[model samples]
Each structure stands twice: as structure tokens, then as C-alpha cells.
Target: MSSPLFTSVHVGGRQATHRVVMAPMTRARSTQPGDVPNAMNARYYSQRASAALIVTEATQVSPQGKGYSFTPGIYSPEQIAGWRLVTEAVHAEGGRIFAQLWHVGRMSHADFHNGDLPVAPSAVAFEGKIWKVDPATGKGEMVDCPTPRALDRDEIRDIVSDFRRAARNAIDAGFDGVEIHGANGYLVDQFLRTTSNVRTDEYGGSRENRLRFLKELVCEVAAEVGANRTAIRLAPFLTARGMACPDILPTILEAVEFLEAQQVAYVHLVEADWDDAPQFTEEFRRQVRARFRGTIIVAGNYDVERANWVLQHGYADLVAFGRPFVANPDLPARLAQGLPIADFDPATLFGGQDHGYTDYSPMQQAA
Candidate 1:
């Protein structure tokens, strides 16, 4: 019998031929000035169309949602047209893709905001940094993040509207569905932790209050795009970027319950994959499985052996490979046939031309 990893699965009411998914990664190669996707981006995605599901890089929903330089946006007409090329390219290859809507919140630098402070749930200091480019040198580097201002009640509502609008734009651009970026110490993750969000208002303090922003954002996006087409990514064990919260696990369970109620498509769980990172308990996995009946995507440092292990045990419906997909476009086929997986060039991973992007060929061409 074949490995369970090769088995077909249903995700968001759509049939995926296999269980290997391409996790979203920040490439920072969008067209400058307008921060739009382009033909090169389309080619890069099309080359990796063999994956069961492709979650595009974290795309900012609005200008205020951007953090790093050169990341793509979905709020403008040109951006929508640019993304259309990507969707068309992937669809032409018979592959499914979802746009990951993102908001960086306080994880931003003032250079992108015209000297204004990045907004968050509270003005708390975040020991975080963002990738920025020096205009004079035209090279990107990690820069420290300054303390951000708290978002007003009305401003919070506006951000939620931005997410809903972004979802609509994704569909208009021919995307199969949309996934909200709620992990990796971004805007939504900031609101979920007490260390980052200490507000006494309706959006902070208690676990329920802290979940209010996520609930509203998810509800609004699902309303614009059907709940069956809406998805979210969450990280429960993430402790970096000043985001360690004692009550986070229970809070995430509550959020999972709400997602089940909304009938959302899937929940993408990002495990802490760094060296010495905390382990994701199997008990928590069982709890989440009991709460949500939809698809569960688990992403971390996973290889073929680990991927099949999770599938055989029913811990996840799909496994997402991040760096592996970068170097091996035909990752599913390579794994299926036991072909050699190539190593990616770290220097050219982001903000570059096709050297390390579309230049990576399939096994036939490589051989």
C-alpha cells in the first residue's frame, strides 16, 4: 500500500489530489513602488503548482497592514490584476491556491508609515524587528521596532473591514479561497496575548475579550467570502517576538470552538520550529480535533517520515512544507518517487530575481 501522504483529501469543499501543502513564506520580491505581484511572481508559483494546496505569501490587506519592504498588497486595482496572473498560472496547471491576508500591526517600521507609529491593540513595547530596506543602499536588513500606538475602537473596526475587503479582492483576482494571517506575532497574534495586549477594554484582558478582535475579523471575512472558503493560521506555542502568554492555549481552544461554530474551512497551526522550540502536545491536538470538524494543517520542520507519521495517526489532514517547497518545485512527486531534495540558496531567498526562485527546476530537468 502507498503511504497515507499520497492519499487524496478534501479541503474547504474542494478535492486536493494529495496531502502535501505549500505553506506561505515571505519572499519580498513583489514589484517595487506599487508593491504588486508580477509575471515573475506568477512563474514562481506556477512552477510549484504540483502541491495539493498553495498558500501564497503573506499579502498585506491594506497599506497600513504592511511591515516588510517589497511584500505584495491586495487592496489596489493594479495589485488585483497582478495577482490575477498568479491565480491564472496556478489554475492553468490544475493546482489550487489560497491568498493569505495579512496585517502586521505593531510589527512594522515607521518608514512604511510616513513617520507615524505602527498601531496595535496597546502601546506596549514589543522587542521585535522587521525587515526594511535602506533607500540609499537598496538592500534589506532587520531593524528594531519602536513602540506602537494603540488602535482606537473605530480604528479596530476599520482594520476588520480591510480584511473583509481583502477577501473579496482575493476572489475577484481568481483565488480559490483566502486564509487570514493570525500567526507569527502579527496583528491578530498580538491581540491574543496578555504580554502584548493589556487593554482593559472589550478587546483585551480576559481571554474572551482578547478573542473579540479575531472573532470579528473572521466573522467579517467569512460574511464577505463564504465560511466554507475562509481559513485562518494560528500559532499556540509561539513565544518569540515578545509573545508568551500563560492563558494562550485555553484562549486558542476558545477560538477554535468559535471557528467550528462559524464553519470555517480550516485552521493552519504553526508549530514553534526553532531550535529548542517547545513541543506541540498531542493532547492539545486531540482537543482541537474534537472541537473543529474541518481540515487541520500542521506546519513545522517536517520531512516525509514525519509527514506520514502525522497522517497515519490522524493528527493532521495535511502537512505544509515551507523551505522544502522553495528548493523543490515538484516536492510531492519527488517525495513520492524518493528523489533527492535540493537545498535552497539562503542569500537569494528574498527580494531577488529568478535565480533562486523560478530557476529551481524539476527532477527531470535537474537530472
Candidate 2:
């Protein structure tokens, strides 16, 4: 018998060839001035088309949603055309792809906002940093994030609209579906935690109220794109960047129930990967499985054995590999044939040309 990881599965209303997914990573290699995807971006994604599904790097929904320099966007005509290149390339190679709609919220620098503060659910400061490139030297560096202003009620509504438009744009650009970037302590994650969100209106004060933003955002996106085609990524166990909340687990359980109600395609759970990170209790996994009937994809420091463990035990339907897929484009075939995997160059991981991106050869070429 073959490993269950090699079997086909239904995800986001499409049939994926296998259970190995390509988790989205920030490459910061979009074209300058317009922050648009380019032919090089298309080639990079096409190379990894062997994954069951490819979630493109977090593409900002709006200009203000941008946090890192050179990340692509989906809100403009140029960006949509640029992403079309990527979707076409991936499809031509017989692969499926989804665009990750994102808004950085307070995880941004004023350099992105023209001296204005980044907006969040509350006017709070966290010990967080964002990646930025110095214009003079053109080198990426991590910089401190200043305190951000709270969004007015109307601005919050506007952001929800931004997500909706981005989803529509993704479909227009020929993606199979769209995944909301709700994990990784970004805008959506910020609203879910008490330490980051201190709003006093209907948007906050209670867990239900805190969840209102996410509920609204999901509902609107699902309405624009069919619920069967809409998906979300959530990090229930994340506590980094001043985001530790005592009530977060129960709150995430509540969010899962709402997602089930909405009938969204899948829930991508990002487990803590660092050595000292808290354990994602199997008990919690059981709880989530009971609540949501949709597909569940898990990503962390997963090896072949661990990936099979989750699938065999029914904890997840698919496993996503980030760095592994970067160095090994034909990751599925390599795993199936037991070929040697290559190591990626961390220095060229971000904001670079094809040297460490599309230049990584498949096993046949390497051999």
C-alpha cells in the first residue's frame, strides 16, 4: 500500500492530485514601483506546480494593507494582470493555485503609509517588527513597528470591502479559489486577541464582539466568492509578538463554529514551529474536527512521518511544506521515489532574482 499522502483529495471544491500543499511564503520579489507580480514570479510558482495546491505568497488586498516591501497586490489592474501570469503558468503545468488575500494592519511601518500610522482594531503598540528595504542601499532589514491608530467603525467596514474586492480580483486573475490571510499575527489575528485589540464598541470588549470583525469579513468574502471556494488560515496556538491571550483557544473554537456555519472550503491551521512553542494539544484538534466538516490543512515543521501521522489519524486532510518545496520543486515525486532533498540558500530567500528561486533544479536535472 502507498502512503495516504500520495492519494487524491477534494479541497476548496477542486480535486488535488496529492496531500502535499505548498504553504505561502514571503519572497519579496515583486516588481518595483507597482508592487506587481512578474514573469519571474510566474516561473517560480510553475516550478512548484507539483504540489497538490500552491498558496501564493501573501498578497496585500490594498496599498495600506502592505507590510513588507516588494510583496505583490491584487487590487490594481497591473497586479491582476501580473497574477494572471502566475495562474496561467501553474495551470499550464497541470496544478491548482489559490491567492492569499492579506491585510497587515498594525504590523506595518509608516513608510508604507506616507507618515500616517498603520490602523488596527485598537490604538495599541506591540513589540513587533516589519521587514523593510532602505531605498538608498536597497537592503532588507527588520525595523521596529510604531504604535498604530485605531480604525474608525467606517474604516473597518471599508477593510472588509477591501477583502471582498481582493477575492473577486483573485478569481478574475484565474485562480482556482481564494484564501483569507487570517493567521500569522496579521490584521485578522490581531483582532482575535485581547492584548492587541482594545476597542470599546461592537467590535470589541467580549469574545463574540472581538470575533465580529472576522465573522463579517468571512461572510462578505464568502458572499462574493462562493463559500465552497472561500478558505481561511488561522493560528490557534500562536502566542508570539505580544499576542498571548488567555481566552484565545475558546475564541478560536467559536470562530471554527462560525466557519462551519458559513460552509467555507477549508481551515488552514498554522501550528507553532519554534522549539519552545506550546504544544497543539490533540484534544484541541479533536474539538476542531467535531466543529468543522470542511477540509483541514496543517502546516508546521512536518516531516514525512509526521505528515502521514496527521492524515492517518484524521487530524488533517493535507500537509503544507514551506522551505522544503522551495529547494525541491518536484517534492511530491522526490518523496515518492525517496530521492535526496536539497537545502535552500537562506540569504537569497527574499528580494532576489532567480538564483535561489527558479534556479533550484529538480532531481533529474540535479543528478
Candidate 3:
């Protein structure tokens, strides 16, 4: 029997070996001072090169875009060179990679930004705690995020340019493409949700205006690098940890239509963060599929069986595995061979060494 997981798929004219994709996961392992990608990360990504498409961890575009400690960036030359090592390592094994560009928006503390307050669509502060690294002890610290400064019109233009520069840097770093991190309550997402953006300017007040920043970013990046090499990730119905959005279906439809017009490579959607949250109904799924003519990758707590079913049923063209890929580097092979998946240690999910990052052994090694 043919396995849908192993079926070959084409994204942006490039043929992928399998339908399994490695979703971008923030490990928070990059050391401070420069946030350069190191050999350890290179090895970590190379180990999972079997994925048809490996969207890298979220990388901030500029210093002002930073939200957490130890996350990598693509703005600096040193950072670009560092990412080059990772891309080269992954490509050596014939794997395609995409860099995820990010900005934390209101989900950041001044401690990580040289005493500068984090920026957001509005001045509202995220009503939760964020994990930061304690410089004194080098351990993770839970800190309350402060209210952000609402970006002015000029600031918005500068932020878009930052994304454009980051896209250029990703290409220079040897990435096959770049995935704009428009999801998970980041800057782009802050503008999308009505609760977060209460401005009366051109960026806010209505649904169409709310999606302006993200749409402009997509167009700008697509101009820099062809639309075929650009993708966007969105968390449509996610409302947790102060990341709430009202009327998700209509908002998503608007964004999807805009993306369709741009002819982007794909639209990566995260239906909801929590399992108990409403799943994407077949009708809503069809609506998105009809709106987006390009590839569609659905993620968020999907197992092998569900992933295969979604693909075979024609709901999603590709399925992205997040925590599963972290705990199982050989996830594609395991799904192909029907091998047992090792349990993931949730305790070691963030800010860990090689214990959970690169130490997940393949089935052959375990045997």
C-alpha cells in the first residue's frame, strides 16, 4: 500500500521527497551577545534532513524585533554566515530548508532589548508571563511583559523594510526560501487581530486595514524573492496566553485571499493551539482550500494517522509535525516503516542542551 506520508509533492516547482514537513520550533539554544547559529544547531537540523521541508526556528529580523533571549536573527552579517552553515549542512543531504522570520511584538520584556520596551500594534500588554534567560544565573526566568509602544506610520514602514532586509539575508544565507512568522501572536499577527490593534490609522479600524501590514509584507518579500520562494504561517483561531483574535474565520479568509492574489508558495495555517479548541471544520477547510490556490500546510498536534488522512482526503497538501519532529528526528522514516515513536520529554522542550535536541536517536540506533 502506498503511504501518503511518503508521497512526493512539489512546492514552488521544487520536488519534495515526502509530504512530512518539520514545523518551525523555537528551541532557545542560541548563545547570547550575538545570537549566532552554532555547530550544534547545524548538527541538529542536519539530523532531521529527511523532512521534505524543514522550516527553521523563528529568527528575529533586527535587534528591535527581538522578543526572547537566545533566539537567532538574520539581520547581521555574522548571523547570516552562521545560518549558512546550517543551510549547507541540510542541503548536503539533499534537504530543502526555509528560514522563519519573526518579531515578538508585545510578547517581550525590556530585559532582552537593552531596556527598550517591546513594540506592538497597540499599547496593550500581553496579559501573561514570558520565559527569559537570567543573565546572572543563565537559567530561564518567567517575567511579566510590559505594555508596548504603538508603532507610528513611519515605524510601520521601517518594520516592513526590516522584513525585506531579512528576506534578502535569508537568500544570502543559502536558504531555499523564507517563511514569514505571521502567527503565534507576533508583530504581523498583532495587526491581524482586532483585540490587539485598536488604532484609528490606516493599519486598523476594519478587517481590511488590519490585514494591511501583513499583506504589504507579503508583497514586499515576494518582490525581493519571488512569490514561489515565500510562505507565511498563521495561527487563525488561537486565543491563549493573551493572544486572542475575534472572528477568526472571516479574518483568515481575507488573509488567504490576499495571499492567493500574491501567488505565494504556500499558506501554513495553525487551526488552534489547544487540542480541545475547535478543529477546522470540513467546510472552513474547503473555504481556505478554495481561497488559496497554492500549497497549504496544516499543523498543530497532528499524528501520523491524522496527517495521512488529511493529505489523502485532499484537505491539506502537506502536514507539519512540531513536537513530534522534535522528539523523533527520524519521524518520516518511522511513519514510513510504521515504527514505534519514542515518547518526547516535555520537560526538556525549551532551553535545553543536546539531551532533547539532538539526542533523539533513530530506530536503527535504538535497535
- Candidate No. with top lDDT: 1
| TM-score for each candidate, following the candidate numbering | 0.99, 0.98, 0.96
Q: Superposing all C-alpha atoms, what RMSD in Å does each candidate have to the true structure? A: 0.9, 0.9, 1.4
Worst 10 residues of 3 by lDDT: 240-249
lDDT of each: 0.94, 0.92, 0.87
Q: Please report the TM-score between candidate 3 and the true structure.
A: 0.96
Where is model 2 more than 4 Å wrong at Cα?
none
Residue 342 local lDDT, model 2: 96
> 184, model 1: CA deviation in Å?
0.5
- Backbone clash count for every predicted candidate, in the order shown: 0, 0, 0
Residues 16-74 of candidate 3 have per-residue lDDT tens digits of 87899999998988755799888889989999998989999999999888877788999
**Which scores better on TM-score, 2 or 3?**
2
lDDT of 1 by residue, 1-367 (tens): 6788999998634687789999999999999889999999999999998889999999999999999999999999999999999999999998889999999999999999999999999999969988898999998899999999999999999999999999999999999899999999999999999989999999999999999999999999999989988999999999999998998999999999999999898999999999998899999999998898888999999998999988888889999999999999999999999999999999988798989999998999999
Ranking by TM-score: 1, 2, 3
In lDDT terms, how accurate is model 2?
A: 0.92
